[model samples]
Target: MIIGLYFWNLLRNQQSNKTAVDRESKKEMEKLRKLRSIQLTQPLAEKTRPQSMKDIIGQKEGLKALKAALCGPNPQHVLIYGPPGVGKTAAARVVLEQAKQHASSPFLQDAKFVEIDATTARFDERGIADPLIGSVHDPIYQGAGALGVAGVPQPKQGAVTKAHGGVLFIDEIGELHPVQMNKLLKVLEDRKVFLESSYYHEEDTNIPRYIHDIFQNGLPADFRLVGATTRTPDEIPPAIRSRCMEIYFKPLLPDEIAEIAQSAIAKLGMPESPEAVRVVVNYASNGREAVNMIQLAAGLAITEGRDRLRAEDIEWVVNSSQISPRPQKKVPKEQKIGYINGLAVHGPNIGTLLEIEVTSMSAEKPGAGKLTITGAVDEEEMGGGARTLRRKSMARSSVENVCTVLRQIGLNPFHYDIHLNFPGGVPIDGPSAGIAIACAITSSIRRVPVHPRLAMTGEVSIHGRVKPVGGVVAKVEAALQAGVEKVLIPRDNWQEMFAGLQGIEVIPVDTVEEVICHAFPEWAESISERGESEGNWIDPSIEPAVQPILPFMQARSTSE
Candidate 1:
C-alpha cells in the first residue's frame, strides 16, 4: 500500500507541475498580447511622405528628370537644388524603387538607398576616420574585439561601401567639407575605397578574406550619388557640379501647400474646415510645414472633443509655434501724390510689396537738385547694410537711373530737391524697383496723384526702356494677395507671368512712357504731348533754365 501511495504521489506531483507550466505559458502569452497592442505612432510628415513618385506634389518636371536619369541603362550622378521641405530626399528614394521596376533600368531588385546629411558627416583629415568612406580600426583602439587583441587590423565599412550597387543620398551637400568632398570625388572616379593600416599584414592568414580583399583590392563602392542642397549653383563646388546632372526643385506654391494639407487630413480620417486649410497655407511655407500644422491642429481639436479642425485651432498652433503670419500690406483707399507700390522677392518665392513715396521742394540754389534717397542701404536704420556693397551700389544706381528718366521726360529734376522715401523705412535693394521710383518722382513733380491700386516692378533704363526682371510670378502673386487691382510688369516678362491669375489685372509695359500713361491716365494727354515735344518744351529761349526761382514761383507754375 505504501508503494502504491508513493507512486500516486509522484503522479500527483507531475500533474501539479504540468498545471503550473500551463498557467505560466498563459501569463507569458497575455504579456505578449499587451505588448503587441502598443504601437508607436509616426509623425504626420513621415507618415504622409510620398511612397511613390505619383504622390509627390508640385514637382512634376523635377520628377520626370530624375526618372530619366535613374531609369537609363547608365545612371549618372544627380544634384538637386531646392529649398527645404520640398521632397528632395523622398523623391530620391522613390525614384530608385521606380527604376527597379523598369526592365531597362540599371537598378537591381535588391538595390538599397543609404541616406546621410552632409551637415552631420564627420571626416578625419589625418586619414584616420571617415563616415562616408571606409575607415580602418587599428588594434590599439577600444572595442576592437578579438581582432584588436590579436594584433590584427579591422576594416569598417561606411555609408559608401554599404550603398554599393545602389544609391547614396546626401542632404545639404553644400555644407560638406572640401577634404571629404575630394575623397568622395576620388571614390566616384574609381568606384572603390582603399584602406590602409600599419597593423594589417598581407602575409597574415588569420585575416578574414573580405578584410584581406578590402586592403588589397579595395571595398566595392560602385554606387550612384544623389546630392541635395538649398544653395544655388554658385555655392556648390565646381568640380562636383560639373560631374552631376543638375535638377532644380521650385518652392511649393500656396495652392500646392493647401492641397498637401488637405491630402494629409484625409489620410488621417479627420474632418477639417476650409478656413482651417486656408489658415494653414498662409502660415506654412512648404508641404512639410503645412502637414505639421494640420497635425497639430487636429490634435488640438481632439483634445477639445471636436472631430473637425477649426481656424482657431490652427491660429493657436501657429502662435504657439512662433510662425509669423504673412505680412498684410493694405492697399490705400485713395489716390495720393508721390506714393507707389514696388514689388520685391524676399527669398526663393516669397514676394513683398514695398511702399515708395517722393516729395520735392525748391532747391536753395539754381542747378542744385539734390536727390536724397531714404530706405536704401545708404539710409541708416533701414537694415540693408548687411547686403553686399555691390547690391547697395546697384540700389543707388537705380535711383540715379530713375532721375535720368525723369529728366528725359521734360521734368526739371535739377530745379527740385527731390526726397525719395520707402514707407516704413524698409530697405529696397533690387533694381526691380527702378520703375516704381521713377513713377513716384514723376507724380511728385507733376503734382498728379498716382493710382493706389496700381503696383509696378521693372528696371528702368536711362533711355526710358523698361527691362525685364526676375520673380514676375512671385511679385504678381504678392500684388493679388495685397488687394492691388493692377500690376505693371515688363513686356518682356509677359511669358514669365503665371497663367490663370485671378482677381488682379497684369499690365505689360514696354517703356516708362506706358507706365506713366497707366499710372496717371487723367494727365496722359499732357504727358504724351510733352513727350512728343521733347526738347522744344525744355528750350532755354521758351522756359527758364531753373524755373523754380522760389516757392512762390513753384506755386504759380503749378497753378498754370
Candidate 2:
C-alpha cells in the first residue's frame, strides 16, 4: 500500500508540471497576439500629394469643374479629354487636395478615395473581383482559420469594402472591357454586395465547426466614382458613356500659359526671363508642348551652369526642338518682253481675243526710248498667231530695227523710257505684244505725246502677224480703269463685242498693219489719208482720230 501511494503521488506531480508548461505557452501566445495587433495599427506608406491648387497647371477648366463638384450638392462624373501632357491626370489629383482643404462637411470625412488605373486593374480578373467583391477563403485568412479553435468559416474583405463610403477614381477608364464595365454598373446600381456562403458543415464538428454566414454581409457601397481618360466617351461602351459626364479639355490660353510658366519657375528653382518665357511659349507647337520644352530647357540650363535663360539659349533649344518656318523666295525681275493682257483681240471668225498691253519702253522720262532685250523665246507658247515672227537675240537689235523702220517713214520716235506690265502676273511668252510695245516706245522716244485716252491691245507675231486675241471685254475694262477712252481690239473680236461694250470705242483691226497705221496717223499719213480718201469706209459714226503731238516742234525738244 505504501509503494502504491508513492507511485500515485509521482504521477500527480508529473501531471501538474505538464499543466504549468501549457499555461506558460498560452501566456506567450497571448503576448504575441497583442504585439501583432499593435504592429498592424501603423499607417500605410505615404504618397506624394500636390502642394497647392495653383501649383497644379495646364488644366484650369478641369480644376474649375472639380471645385464646383465639391462645392455643389451634386457631384458630376468628370471626363477630361485632350492629347497627352495636357494634364488630364494631374487635375483630378488636385481636385482631391482642394476638396480636402476647402470643401465644407467635406466628402473626405466619409468618402473614401480609391484610385485604380483602368488600363491595368479593370482587365485583371483576379484584381477585379478581388477588389470589388470580397474573396472567398483567401489564403491570407487561412492562418486565422487554423488559429480559431472553433473552426469558424469566414469571408475575406476586398478593397471595394475598404473604399466603402468613398470615391473611386479610375484613370484611363475608356480601356475597361465590356464585362468589367458591366460589373461596375452593377455595383453602382445595387449600392451593396450580398455574399452568400456556408462557412462549414455541421459534420466537421457536432458543435458546428463553421458559421453558416461568413462574409461581411449587407455592407453599403456609398462610394462615388470619378474616372479620367484621354479617349472620347464615344469610344467607350455606350452604357458606360450614358452613365458618366464628359467635359472636353481645351488648350490653355497665353495668360494661363504664363501662369504655368511662372509656377514651374518658382517650383523648380530655375531662373527665367520674360522674353525667354515668351520665346518658349510662342516657339512651342502647343501649350503643353511648350511647357514640356520649357521644363527641359530649364533643367538643361541648371546642368549647364547658367542662371538666367538667355535669348540665345531659348532660340537654340527652339531651333533644335521645333520646326522653322519656310523662307519666302524672291521674285525674278520683270523683263521688257511681249505680254498679253485679257484685252488683246484676235480676228473675228478665229474667236481669239486677248487684251494685250504693249510696253513700248520703260517710262523713265515719261517717253518711249530704245530698248535692250535678251532671253530665249518659248516657241510652243506662240500658237498659230504668226509662225514667221523671228525671235530676236538682243533688245538692242530689235530696238534698232524698229527705229530704222520708223526713220524710213520720217517719224522720229525717240528719247523715252518704256515699260510693259501685264494685268495678271502671267509671263508674256509670245511676240504678240512686240509691235504694241514698239509703238508705245516710239511715241515716248519721239517726245511726241500719244493720246492719253487711247489704249492698244494687239499681239505682234515674230513675223508681224498681228494675231487676234481673246477676252477683249476684260482688257477694255482694264483700259477703262486706267482712264482710256478708245480700245483697239482685233477686228475679228468687234462683232463679238456684247451690247454692254458702249463705254469704250472698240476699234477693230484685221492685221498688225492696221494697228500701226491707226496708232501713228502722223507717221503713216498715206494710210490715214486713204481712210479719209475712202469717205464711206471711214465711218462718220467713228470718233475723229486724235492728233495730239508734243507742243514743241523741234525734233529734239529743249527739255530733251
Which candidate has the highest lDDT of all?
1
The per-residue C-alpha lDDT of model 1 at residue 24 equals: 100
**lDDT computed for candidate 1:** 0.83
Model 1 misplaced stretches (Cα beyond 4 Å): 1-38, 198-209, 328-336, 349-354, 378-392, 412-414, 423-426, 449-456, 460-560
CA-lDDT, candidates in order: 0.83, 0.52
Q: How many clashing residue pairs, candidate 2?
A: 45
Error of 2 at 53 (Å): 3.9
Predicted structure with the largest TM-score when compared to the true one: 1
TM-score of every candidate relative to the true structure? 0.75, 0.42
- What local lDDT does model 1 show for residue 290? 89
CA lDDT, candidate 2, residue 85: 49
Report clashes for each candidate as comma-separated counts: 0, 45
Model 2 lDDT per residue over 292-369, tens place? 656666657878888666666667777787645311111123312233222332211111223333444433453356
Tens digit of per-residue lDDT, candidate 1, span 305-359: 8888888999999889999864567788998898899998765445778899899
Q: Compute the lDDT of residue 278 as modeled in candidate 2.
A: 74
